[model samples]
Target: MQDPLPQIVDSHCHLDFDDLAADLPDVVARATAAGVTRMVTICTRLRNAAHVRAIAETHGPVFWAAGTHPMSVADEPMATLDELEKLARHPKFVGIGETGLDYHYTAETKALQQDSLRLHIEAARRTGLPLIIHARDADDDMARILTEEYRAGPYSCVMHCFSSSAELARAALDLGFYLSMSGIAAFPKSAELRAIFAAAPLERILLETDSPYLAPPPHRGKRNEPAYTAHTARVGAEVFGLDYADFAAATSTNFDRLFWKAAAWAKAA
Candidate 1:
């Protein structure tokens, strides 16, 4: 018989989004069959928190986090520390954000995005949950604000779907934060990006699909799901020059370390 696949977690995904949510049972089943035993579904808008939380509440292997997306910062009501803190109280809530600056398309919202990010950081600090960051063209500011807030009071974080500069990677690593590997790291031409991860400590890495988006090769250009986390893990194993089982073990341990609530929940179960 074939050996069972190594277990790994899809540390970030969007199960509340319509594409995946429409067929939630199937998406989750596929993820389980792929050896992705758990997933964190992010709520990008405060208004959708109820829906996002519901998905986690109903799904056994799913947990969740919430914050405003940078692009939506300009139009959506700013997220409050109290609001985010309340959300963090949920049994299934395990992280602070898919939050941080994104200047690529929404440079206009820079100031507001920064403010929102700080608020989320405060929530993470008060709640002691990991902060999930979505950084894009604003690496410099992203690095700066995270450093500034971290100095004020340390908090756990992960640079989710990391495809930024090596400098930013080092900055995040220096602060003892994690860099999550997503489908982007598996692209044929992402050598530079992979090298960034390769240089970072394996103990500080996580795997994600950023699903319904950035599906890795073979599934490239298609909708991503938690199952695709295994594909990214395959590439991560190659980048680290370790066997897939070893790489999966390291990332899974890293996930539990950074996402301690999820770890505690699993232990309690």
Candidate 2:
């Protein structure tokens, strides 16, 4: 028999999205078979929190986080600190957001996005959950806001699907925040991105698929799912020059450290 693959976690994904939700059981089964033992499904809109929360409640290994995505900050009802604080009370709610600036598509809403990100940061501080950030083409502002708010009071965080500047990486790391490796880092043309991750301390790295999006090479352009996290983790091992099992263990430890609620829940189970 083949040796068991190293266990790992998909630190961020959107399972409530129709593509993955349409066939949830099979999708989760494939993830389990591939050794992705846990997944954090992110709810991008506060309105969808019920649906996302239910997905986690029904699935044994799924946990969740909720926030108003920066791209939708202008469109969706603005999120409030009280609402986010209440959501954090959920037993399976493991993080504060997939929140931050996404100026690439929504530069017009930059101010609103910054406001939302600060509220999410406050919620993360209050709940003691890691803040999940999604930054795109707003590195300067992203770094600035994170630094300013962190000075107001430190809160744990992870830059989810980090494909940003090396300076931003250094800024985040300087704040003791983690940088998550998504499928993007595993693409053939992402050598520079991979190098950025490789240069970071291995203990601060976490693995994710960010699916149903950014499926890694060999599955690039295809709809992604938690099962594909192993593909990215394999690349992470190469980037760190460690065996696959060792990389998996390291990332899993990083995940537990940031998403401690998930670890606590698993232990209780």
Candidate 3:
């Protein structure tokens, strides 16, 4: 019998990163073979934005996001809101960021990061494209900024690769943003996250590989790719005690709603 659950969508990836680009075609083919039929390559810098766009255009099943990563923004050319707003309007660029606060390294100043993120949020408001956020060790700030910006305009956001406090998770969900889970949820000791996964609404949850990193259990510490999204999906299904096919379909549905229109998926048999 054919599986009732639909194919998987890797909601976030750095497939344009050098490691994946070196073997892009093979990577896509293998991912398709594994039922990960669609993927989104996120942009981390404007200079490499063209490469992100090219991958999406080249692959009928792929989509892409533009706008600089917060960490990359400080040293990047499009260092102003106007510059970010200009670049985020490309028809192929469906989302505004990998932009948000990241205080993990302690090297980038918080004020600088907030300015960069605020710029991207404004761009998202103008473009009406969803914002892909990367929040690490700054969930409090991430939540605060998102709340503050909400009053400014109607803009969508995603806590990409979510690994934050329950309070932050609750705040984001309350504000109608999706929480994207990656391979990290599959780690042996991620009981707390698995607990959070249990309560998160199926509709509001999304899955990703964040490839070239966060390779799940069996493939842990290995070079990750979109094809490995199945591992993450499997883990997610287990977390919710859901039928694997059902969870896959739910996650894919969230991906479609959050990303740009795709004829390939809309016209799927």
Query: Best by lDDT, which number?
Result: 2
Give each model a TM-score: 0.98, 0.99, 0.93
- Model 1 spans > 4 angstroms off: none
Candidate 1 backbone overlaps, count: 0
Which ten contiguous residues of candidate 2 have the minimum total lDDT?
73-82
- Flag the better candidate by TM-score, 1 or 3: 1
Candidate 2 residues 1-269, lDDT tens each? Answer: 98888999999999999989999999999999999999999999999999999999999989999999999998899898899989999999999988999999889999999999999999999999999999999999999999999999999999999999999999999999999999999989999999999899998999999999999988999999999999999999999999999999999999999999999999899
Segments of candidate 2 deviating more than 4 angstroms: none
**Per-residue lDDT of candidate 1, residues 84-191 (tens digit):** 988989998999987999899999889999998999999999999999999989989999999999999999999999999999999999999999999999999999
RMSD values, in order shown: 0.8, 0.8, 2.2
lDDT of 2 at 119: 90
**Residue-by-residue lDDT tens digits, candidate 3, 1-269:** 97543588888889888888899999999889889887888888878877788888898667788766766656776556676667665555668888888788744667888888888898888777788999888987888899999877878888899889899999899988999989999999998988887788988899999998999989999999999999999999998788888899888888777774432334562
Question: How good is model 2 by TM-score?
Answer: 0.99
Report clash pairs, candidate 2: none
Q: Residue 48 lDDT in model 1?
A: 95
